[model samples]
Target chain A: MELQFKSELTISESGFLFDHSTGLTYTLNSTGQFIFRKIQDKQNAMHILNFVMQEFDVSEETAHKDLDDFVRQLKEFDLVSR
Target chain B: MTEKKAYSKPTIIRHSVGVQNKFGRPPATVPINRLDGFEVSELAEKYGSPLFVLSVKALRDRYRDLKRAFSTRYPNFQIAYSYKTNYLKSVCSILKQEGAWAEVVSGFEYDIARNIEVPGNQIVFNGPYKSHEELTRAFNDGAIVNLDNYDEMQVVEKVASELGKTLEVGIRINMDLNDPPWHKFGFNVEAGHAFEAVKRAEAGGKLKVVGLHIHTGTYVDDVTIYSRAAQGLVNFYSYIQEQLGVKLKYWDLGGGYASHNTLHGAYLPAEQTCPTFDQYAEAICPILMSGPFQAQDAPKLFIEPGRAIIDEPFSLITSVVSQKRLPSGQRGVLLDSGMNIMSSVQWYRYNFQSAQDSGTMLEDTIVYGGLCMNIDVLQASSSIPPVRRGDLLVIPHVGAYNISQSWQFIYLRPAIIAIEDGEVYVIKKAETRDYVQGFEDVPGKFITN
Candidate 1:
């Protein structure tokens, strides 16, 4: 089965996420939700990681590590593809 | 055959001052899990984010504490749950089960009290504006109707005369405290308005004066203020008895009790600043229990305490939507809940805590609600533990006013759940698209997209 990113993902201000394409919903923590929003802008992993680091006080190294793990989970759930 | 592994990645570790205590090193790790014994994450998952969870245990405990304080101090006293605080059926029902009579300000609240089966005489009708219909309903039900002004008195008299039934009424007397004065919602005693209202009710013959009611002001932490108020009421009561030969059956000190929730500009936490119920009783009960007052028929003491009773039991569980850095390097947390549900956000400095003990340092951040409005800020410059998207944030002491005063704007309000005996029951269902559209009228032309 081919997996493609769909614009059907709706992010609510309260951190609720729903993917109409898959009929599945997910909730993000404050940080996870922030990264998902950044990813929606179609930025590269490094650019997203940099954005997270600048916005949050987290170090670039920590941001990159957290972002990589988050991307892996998103891929596993078929929410995003490389 | 051996399966090939994925590419190796570096693990970035974040550091923060862990939950530490005095005497050096991190304190004994007290796990932040279930609040009041209800699992935080499980509640969020089941009820959906931005839900309101009320703890029956907290409500019962606070109610018992307040009741015991007055009942022990004063010989005769009755507590009426101020319905305006939170009229959620489940909340009111629990309070009714706890033996609290309903005290309502408007006809709507009166109807709710009636619907809940709180006896007619048990309901105290308060507030400045009472229509003829409302007065007739309350009078017919034998509810204690508190007259706010002379205009309302004439209306009551007219209604009672028309019905040919004498209705028991009370006059809300406003007295001048030491510095600040209560201007709205009562007849001023010093200005002779209260005396006039009392005289009119007595002469009407259709209205019987049975009670005297007064609510000094909101957020009153000083017991001395209430003592002064009680002294004023007692003096007024004595005057009425001596001049008009009328004895009241009850004296109502209206609701304004301060809950343990901190105020926006307070120097100390509310728990430390607010006077306990015992303190309040110690002040007012003596005046009622005094020798001269006791010599005559001691009236039943009625206290309508709303916020102090319900504020601590409820928590707003909201999911963190996003985190961003402001231009000034301040962290801003956007959550799913906003001013729509938590109306008290305008005046209260809500205490937000993490659901799980994530080993992150505390940072000062501005918490924003899901609403698109610029005024949707929930907390401006609050210190919260390092939080991320998907983390559940628990806002405590939101039992009062939030639900009763919530507004429906952009999004549907979440469900209200009551957790009791380790069981979760939905008292109110979350709103959905269909629920919003159910009332919307759509023309056929608008259906084409």
Candidate 2:
């Protein structure tokens, strides 16, 4: 599925994310920032998983779990939509 | 070439309005690696996970410390280890070796004491329901039998008449102590029921009333209730002596002392709330010492301590089965242990410690047992260090009711090991399918094997 984030959502390099529609603020860890940056660049879940697995010394299962959990939280907060 | 950075789970913290102390400083995680100088992991490996590890040193020390606290203060004091708390034969044997007499409340427990060769004279049999056969056995064996009601008195009188011997008995009395009273087991002293029972027993002529017993409620954090119980029992003792002219030789202040395990709703840990053995002794001994009887004719002050003596010596070792994040944004971890084996979790917030020193990224976690039932939660709210699947967790202060009340529900009960002088001894073997189904009888038609 195409990973789509809110059009007006603002993100910073230091892992600060703010959604204009909900006015909710979030702080992400470095790994989470990398995934969100990929999502903001309109990357798909598969590409993001591959990027995380390649960038960090993580197994495919760990990278997949992290990507899924991050995406779930993003969807839970209405920051991302399919 | 540069190495790739280590991977940690990607995490996000949402900052919402009115959220105070969001992600507050994680509580320090002090892992419990060794118990009695034996590695918990090694013991778990040897005995299997979800095991019960008991410390013989702790058991003997707790019993001795409690006995010393009372005997040093009051010269005529005696301790009878209550059996219903943890009726493991090995546990009872240890206390027996420590010079404690057996205090049983049921026919089964009485049988256990007998099977352990605890002489009837050394057994203080106290409870409401004692069958005629049990009473006869106790009386014939010269056990200190405390009659609970008029019905029991009549039965005892009949037993004494049949034996053609006048049997000495103690009447269990209960008073309104303003702290949740245990009026179920004994005759009510406030309502004059105890006096009436004593008078009836005396007039019967077959039973001689020689003792008065009272048991306050269990896990009594307040020490003053003991003081009140002592004073009330003493007053009743004097009244019985003066009015009925019956001299009492025993005054049993039954066990309800709190252990180091925290109660469910307490704000502070039990170590801070529970009264010390010295405090309990101070609350009780002074009054009994200055009672209506002199030193030479002083009534034997008997205490039946089960929880305080047994609770701190045992620890439960469980392994994490799986982890999940619940809908409420809380961590949920499942363990091989459950309410079936650790039933005392209903009344206590038992401390769970990491068996290994995992990093200190403490998370708010809820621990569930392996049971399919929803009520199998071990800890409703806990702050624990990050533990992966198969990581060992040790729960201390579970030696009291966990074993005696443990049920062989869905999972077979685990083994119990006693660490004595740095050596491991298996007290109870893990329940196998054969052991669980040993007593079952299936119809031939229903069994298609």
Candidate 3:
């Protein structure tokens, strides 16, 4: 599945995410920030999983789970659209 | 190339108003690697995941401690182990070895006592329903069968006359002690049902009323309830003697003693709220001692202790099946054990600890069982540290009602091991598909199809 971040959202290198439309701020861990940046760069779930596995010492299953969890949370916050 | 740092799952925590502060206090967690000097990992590897471990020493000690607390205060006292709480043969055998009489509520429990070689005279039969055959058997075996209602009194009278025996029986009385009254099992004293039942039993020539039984309720933390119930039992005993001219031989104050397991939604832990065994003895024994009856005429005191002696002596160890972040930004952990085996989680906030140290950061997490149902949650919310798949979680104070109430659901039940003097042995074997299917017989037509 593909995801696009809302245009009004602003993200920082320090793992802070802000949504101008909703006035809501979300704090991300380093892994969440990495996945969020990948999603913003128009990367798909497979590419994000690969990137997470290569960037950290995690198995394919764990990286996939993390990517799925991150995308689900993004959808729940309305920070991204399908 | 340098090695990459260890990875934890990505988390996007919503920083919104009224959101629970994840970083409040340090995680109330400590690694529970060993229980009763046995390694939890070793036990799980040996028996299987989701195993129950019972301490034989704890069982004997709890029974002895409760017995000492009451027997020292009241001279003519007997502790009958309540079979319904946990009727594991090993557990019952240990209590029986400690001189505890069997307190059974059903024919199945009575059969278990008899199978364990507990003599009928040492058993006190108490329950709401007793079949005519069961009453005949109990009467023939010389068990102290307590009548729950008037119908039971008539059945007992019939059985006694048919066998040409003057059977000694007891009547269970329920009264409003201001605590939650258990009116379902016994005749209500406040409503005069208890007096009427006793009078009817006296009118029946074959049945003799020799004991008075009252079960206040289950998990009673307040000592004053027992004091009031004891006082009520004493008052009723005196009335029976004056009006009916029958001297009761025993008073069976049925079990409701609370263990040190925290009840769900309670402000304080059970350790802070529940009265100790000594405190309960003090509340009960004083009233029985202070009764107007002389030393020679004092009634024998019987307290059926189920949870108090059984709860703390057992622990359940389950392995983490998986972990994930829920839509609410909370951590969710799925365990190999479920509501099928851990049924008491509905009422208790059981003490759960990790079998190994995972991390120091505490997170808001919900513990789920492996069951497919939505109600299979073991813990709705717990502030625990990060746990990986296969990590063991130890749940203590689960000895009461869990085994007897648990059934074969989706997953087969696990084994239970007993540890004593550093030696561990299986009290119950893990269930297998064949064992579960052994009771079934496929029809010939279905097999042909």
Candidate 4:
């Protein structure tokens, strides 16, 4: 499955994400920013895990656990659609 | 190697028209995470969630400030702690320790004061519903029970005659203060009923009207209202002295002082609009000190300031239970508390802040209490930071009636913690299933089901 971000959103270099549709703003941490950029590029769940395991010094299991929870939270926030 | 990132919930907020932009200045969004140096999370974790954190220092300082404000201005002034505002044993004990006379409204509140052994003469009893037994006991104990209506006056007279004791009491006089008259409590002074009642009671020869009490309204913010109410009572004081030859001992200006909580739909926050203690003292003290009452003969001033003195000393500590997006695109946050816990939120827009740093996004969020009913809302469109689940929240200005008015409905009531001498003491234990059901009896016939 692919994760796609809505087009009405903007992500800044400093991890500030603003939704133009809702006129709302949010801050993303490093992990959240990593996932948001990957999902914007239409990365699948496995590609996201592989990226966190390399960028952050985390084992494959920690990356798998955190990225799954992060993506599910993003889905809950309606920032991304599956 | 990279460090693990501190994660907050993935959050989205919509800039609605009426949510954040409100009331010129934004609502009080002061970041308050602790009460008297004790972190909110520590109190919640140790005692329970939805707890009431009361500062003993705040209570003493408020009472002393009010006492100084009035006592320094007027020659004689006495404060009676109105028990109905908050009758927790610990609160009452602190007030009594602070040199406050107990003002109870019911037989139950009177007993609470007495159980703490507040002097009977120091206790002022005022309410509409008083039984014959309660009045007899009040008079016997020399408690200054104010007569509310004719029935209560008759009860006092009957009991005084039967026990062969001359009763010295006060009468709560209701009159117009340019607002609609409150006529249900006592005899109407405007309609001459107060004059007639005093004469009749004096003629009965058993009840001596020692004082006159006037409680015009609640949340009384106007100094003019207080001035008018005091003037009206003073006029009656002169009338009673002129016609019946009785020198009134005191004037119980009943409590209605407003606190710093903003009222719903008010243009100004109560901190700005509500009259200060000094203003209230200046307005009413001049009236009592100048005319008719001599410098030495100024009838002692007795005040029952409930909310103004108590509202600031305590706060309700609750936790965010869940978050929901309302259909109207507003953020809906549910707290483990609601009207059941913070009952004053029904009228006042209390200040709520996240116990921990939730987020910087200051948005208008609707807070709901942990109840199934719709009226269980704590704040309607309060400007608060994005609160994450399990993060504790502190809501202030709840010291007045929240505890006294709190009920056990969907969930049992929460614990009450009073910060005394820099230590947390649970003055009231959190209600358990058995404590809530202790008085509930299951009939034997219905138990089979």
Among the numbered candidates, top lDDT falls to 3
Put down candidate 1 lDDT per residue, B1-449, tens digits, no spaces: 44332211211111235433343222212334686677889888877998898888889999999999999987778999999989999999999999999999899999999998999988989988989999888878878889888889899889988888787888898888846577787788899988888898899788889889999787688788899889888889889988888788899988788888878877666767778889999899888776235534678889999899999999888888987656554568899998999999887887887787764435557999999998999999776765668888888899889989998889999999998887788999999899878988979898997
TM-score of each: 0.80, 0.88, 0.86, 0.86
Give candidate 4 misplaced runs (Cα > 4 Å).
A1-82, B4-6, B10-30, B440-449
For each candidate, the alpha-carbon lDDT, in order, equals 0.80, 0.86, 0.87, 0.81
Model 3 residue B152 CA deviation (Å) reads 0.8
Chain A superposition TM-score, candidate 2: 0.92
How many steric overlaps are in each model, in order? 13, 0, 0, 0
On TM-score, the stronger of 2 and 3 is: 2
- Superposed by TM-score, candidate 2 places the C-alpha of residue B316 at a distance from the truth, in angstroms, of 0.9
Q: B306 in model 3: Cα distance from truth in Å?
A: 1.0
**Candidate 3 lDDT, B319-407, residue by residue in tens:** 99998768776779999999998899999987668888754445567999999999999999876666778889999889999999999
Better of 3 and 4 by TM-score: 4
> Is candidate 1 or 2 superior in lDDT?
2
Candidate 2: where are CA atoms >4 Å away? Answer: A1-58, A70-82, B3-28, B445-449
TM-score, prediction 3: 0.86
By the DockQ metric, which is better: model 1 or model 2?
Answer: 2
Share of native C-alpha contacts between chains A and B (below 8 angstroms) recovered by candidate 2: 0.70
In order, what fnat does every candidate score?
Answer: 0.00, 0.70, 0.76, 0.16
DockQ of each: 0.03, 0.52, 0.48, 0.20
